[model samples]
Target: MSIQDQEHTAEPSSSPADSAGTRRALRADLLRVGKIGGARSATSSAAVIEGHALIDRRTGVWVPLAERRRQAAAGSPADQARWDRLIEAVTRPTQPTEVSYEKLVVRVGSARDLLRTLADTLPPFVPVAEVAQRIEQRVESGTYPPGAVLAPGRIAADLGLPLQSVHLALSDLAGKGVIEQQANCRARVPGANPFNDRPRQLAQLLRALAAGGAFPPGTALPGRRELCRILVTGDKPFAAALRLLFQEGLLERDVRQRLTVRRGSVKRTDPPKLPAPAGHVKSLRDDEIPEAARRTRAWWNARLSPAPAALDQVIDQLGATAHQLVDRAQPGSVPPSTAQQQLSALVARTAITAAAVHHPHFELRLWHAACLATAVCDLLALLDDLDASRPSRRTAMPPLL
Candidate 1:
């Protein structure tokens, strides 16, 4: 055949049937390209071809060709180069091939399973404040009562935290006075020191009574046992309260050992400031008093004897002596020589109190008293340091040694 006849034969026929077949083949090719290029719909393919747009590979969105060109023109030379590469890739003709189907088998499971899987992958972080808060909550709720020891290893296991974190938390609590810890000892909830629960409560109640003029200055008070019965307290606490009062200079002892209110110590103008809610001497109804008193006396009888009361009285008197010494050492109120002498005496008394713990007749009460004495001595020492650091108000006393 001639050259023109060969070209005509290569071109598609213009007849109606042939034209319809050719259009169908072209449409199928465009559809195949759309699927491969990640065009979601027919409109996306139309946008790419007719509206001068390209399908973004990352987002699968059709970006306008004009906008891309404008950005490339305004951007850096590297950006323009990147734009050129992208446009070249989009415009490159792709071959038509067989479309393969992907199964995309999705296995659905419960949300719990997914969460557990995630939990296995991610490590949990436990903060120090969280551990401290847990301990504080337990203490406040009485889960850990006073005198209860807190073990760091046990806490670590319970909290799923590291042991070092627990120790740091405990040290922080100790510093804040939320708990107490000694060298080589575990942390513990602090309890009443130098006296048992009842004795401290009774002492406070008696102080309130004396200050409120229930027992006026120079007034001879009732017998210890009688006062104990009247106040719904035990004999031990009553005696301890009297000793405490005597130490505080609120009470005096006669030659016969009878307790009397000291002269010039009453503050009758103010109403009676009662003890906290935990005290035994609460505001009771007339009928409730008898039952409460009976219960208290029975408890006391079952638990303890009155033999230790005398020894406790001696320890308390020693604490009283220390208090007097500390008072004499008050800054700006006494001469330097006098303050030094008083401090020296205070130290000797404290050492004696501490030494008593090693004595043959040492008891739990004596140990508590020693602890109290040591605490008082430390407090006095702190005050002395503070006084030394402060600017002296008196010309006779210098700020520094």
Candidate 2:
């Protein structure tokens, strides 16, 4: 009967086809999948049976449709019946079965290769220095396409960097005329970017060296050009820094010819050791902050706008601590895929009741608490979904149509 005639007849639409026809239909499904990139694409395309062949998703091979048609022509009635179900599956819209293809990167090698593979699998940590350097490098290297908006907040969140640092770096770039920035704080690279922190560090080191008599009182410092080369700061910034020292009475200069260190400017590196407190009295040691607490405090201070005096100090501390934390981690430890996830988990798990109760801005405190609660619930739900999708939680596969 014709397909239209069969529909009019009072009979079941699907029944067992002969093995030959079933195989032919199967060939068609495979060909559809092979024609696409993989299962993911094939599932979308729904192109299981084309005119001539079956595409094999597994081996990425295809079988000729002409051969399948011949096979079907010779198949028993039962074989044709099986083809009905398979054709419905391949040609009709339906949810796809879950299939995962694992990529195994194999190499013929010895110990070095083994170690390298192991190393590559470990999670990589992004520290502040590298974060700053990466941004500057990309901007200078023209990695960001022209006219792209540089959003510091988005970059900070994506990279798990302190937002303040991104703002500072971008601001510095703007100040140096390396980048074009609007008053609204959006920035784009016209060409320039960050100079390293070495200049300020060099300035401080010179202060310390001068205190240590490397440049004695009444000494005439080297010419500004020489200082620029030594300090790694451009002439303008280096001169500005020197003026600060001069204003502080650390140095003096003849109007026409030279600069000299003030005789009385050099001082002790640190205060003399304090005497031990008597028993039952509080000592400075008793109030010393722990490293982690210090870091958290610095984080808070560093984020404040108007760029307080403590910003640079805290940033330096944070950078050093970042390295220290990495060092303390076990060598083979796996870094989390995302630092943001870890931060989210930490915030979710933390208790802020006491702070909320006593906070000056109690409404804001409650709002923040609400935000955290929402984040925790969302994160937990995502985790549950991921767990459900894994093989261990999967039920038996749905039977094919």
Candidate 3:
């Protein structure tokens, strides 16, 4: 019967054939988006499917779709309590299952991959230095089509980057409001795209050097003004980029009126790191947190079952120690001995808290904490250097012979 006829007949419209057809359509749309370099969209499709599958199966959080669906269709709640955030995503969209094809097709990836890739490759941590250079290289190689604009076709060809990568980069740049998407869906290079400023200067300089054969390992470069016009920045950024290249050992300039590329140990500019996309727990509402955190706490509780009561005691002790440190810290006054003792106490508290928090997903947190520790150490080192440079309060107390 026709779709209209089947609807009118009302004999449980979602027959096996109908369900199979929907799945096929979803899969086909998925592949098409993937082939066009829209991996983010493809991932979204996967997320939608996994989400919907959870709802259809009526399973609890954390249960995989395959098992949840089996239980849901069977009208069993055996796996329902185990329903996870995946199930939430599936059922959360207000639209009925019948209209979810478009959205589902757009997002089709595992939750782990989405979270991990964003954590790994998203910017602020993922540097764009190399990416920008790669783009510059392509622009100079004449791989990009010559135009008044950075057309997508030319952009993809010039960089030898796939359309999807270009699309994503373009989207990123657009989000920053650097480039505007035109009426025809083309990207128009804004008059002052911030990412363009430094890159354009660097590109011009590289091109000038390439043309003049001054970029080879031992060739010297021209004077400041001669190179300055080729580069495009004001006094500060221009000088900064050049100084950066020098520091990286890429360019060696002498008082003699010229510069040359260093033979080895040349460092390239690194990119800015991107922030990780917000994750499941962070994405939840305030009211939803106690429940989710309780789940997480329960998992931890189970893992620590061997010494549950003991762990609780230790956590209490740690919290008590933290409170004492704060309470003892006097207002507007610091005795040198007290300050030193307080620093030691803070360190002890951090170690204790870390030990008590025992979580499988805490690696990223620890990595960041370690970075902060390194920065603190470096700052302390600088202070020591400064202190040593000055006269001691009592020179006689420091005679270490």
CA lDDT of each prediction against the hidden true structure: 0.45, 0.38, 0.38
The true-structure Cα RMSD of candidate 2 reads: 26.2
What are the runs in model 2 whose C-alpha is more than 4 Å off? 1-203, 254-256, 268-401
Q: Which ten residues in a row have the lowest lDDT in candidate 1?
A: 99-108
Selected candidate, larger lDDT, 1 vs 2: 1
* Model 2, position 70: C-alpha lDDT score: 24
Best by lDDT: 1
Candidates in order: C-alpha RMSD to true structure = 27.7, 26.2, 23.1
Q: What root-mean-square deviation over C-alphas does model 3 reach?
A: 23.1
Candidates sorted on lDDT, descending: 1, 2, 3
lDDT of 2 by residue, 1-401 (tens): 32223224423212124545434444433333233333442343232222111112221121133224325433223223333333332232233332212111011111122222222212342323345566676565544434446778766754566665466556555655656787777898663323223344345545654654335466677688865533333577677677678777887875656877777787733211112223433311212224423433333223212122333333233223322222222122223434323332222222121112123232222222232232233333444344444444334322110
Sort all candidates by TM-score, best to worst.
1, 2, 3
Cα displacement (Å) at residue 80, model 3: 31
Candidate 1: tens digits of C-alpha lDDT, residues 1-401: 32223324433322122434434433432332233322332234332332121122211121243234426344233324434544444332343221111100000111112222212212253445566777777667544557666778766765566675577567667867889997767788888433335566566655555554445467677786656544555576677767777777888877777788777876653321111222222333324333433433332333222234444444444345444434434435344564444444334333333333223322334333433344344435545564765455644333221
| 24-71 per-residue lDDT for model 3 (tens digits) | 433433332232213342355554454444333221222243343335
